[model samples]
Target: MDRGGLVVELGPGAGGTTRAILDALPPDGRLLSIELNPHLHRLVEAIPDRRLIAHRGSACELPAVLAAHGFAAADAVVSGIPFSTMPRAVGARTAAAIAECLAADGRFVAYQASARVAELCSPHLGTPRVDTELLNFPPMRVFRWERTGG
Candidate 1:
């Protein structure tokens, strides 16, 4: 959150947001992208950046993934997963992982078409700061959840 040392992006489909996050990183910054789909994972992996680690994994495994990458926690996490369409149990598990894997001052950010993530993530990620982006084709909502006393 504060200048970004290690960033994690969940479900980086086609690398659109990946490019944005990579560009925002400082020289010492690194981004770990977790994409489940083989095709989309390959697309993100094709991006030529020394700082990007495109992994074929699910967000539910974030703790293990980060540990495998030699990171205890992330500075910030960005998710593109559509929690609204996913089963509540699955979404809760992934959301919990995001919270647990975040550093003390870490942030959990999500860009979703619906507001479902606000309810799904708040219990773990604390209060959310939300904004609407009407510029997109279907107008998506952006939610940033920061860590607080849990």
Candidate 2:
């Protein structure tokens, strides 16, 4: 995979996707990851990648967090957050943050087990494009959202 621009990953639990992102990024590309869980943060930190910076923080604070790291906007925001398990308020805040941090053309990709894309993101995201990934455990779906000047 060819790394294109600045990439921000939210809730990269266990670093599975973080490793993949590191491999996909170009030498000069940047990868900023936010993990709310302390254990998950430590796990991802173990991966050796100069381009990867793992932050033990909440996704709801993404804009400030990314800006503090010198990132004005991200080209892509990937999330493995457990949206289905989170309360509506928590998920709404996270979705709002993700939308805020993304560039106009940036893609927000979220991995989920259920097909409740609209229900989980409609409060923050405009309209999402859903794609199913049967290969994932429990047959998950990937929701890709683009910011529409909200």
**Which candidate should be chosen as best, given TM-score against the real structure?**
1
Per-residue lDDT of 1-150 in model 2, one digit per residue for the tens? 255578998898999999998887899888999999999899998888888888999988998999899888988888888887777688778777776778877778888886554575666666778888988778878888876553
User: How many clashing residue pairs, candidate 1?
Assistant: 0
In angstroms, the error of model 2 at 53 is 0.7
TM-score, model 2 to reference: 0.89
User: Model 2 segments beyond 4 Å from truth?
Assistant: 1-4, 147-150
Against the hidden true structure, what lDDT does model 2 obtain? Answer: 0.82
Candidate 1 accuracy as lDDT: 0.89
Determine which window of 10 residues in candidate 1 has minimal summed lDDT: 141-150
Computed on alpha carbons, the lDDT of every model, listed in order, comes to: 0.89, 0.82
Query: What are the per-model numbers of colliding residue pairs?
Result: 0, 0
lDDT tens per residue, model 1, 38-135: 99999999999998998998889999999999999998899999899988898989988988889887778899998888887888766899999999
Best lDDT among the predictions, by candidate number: 1
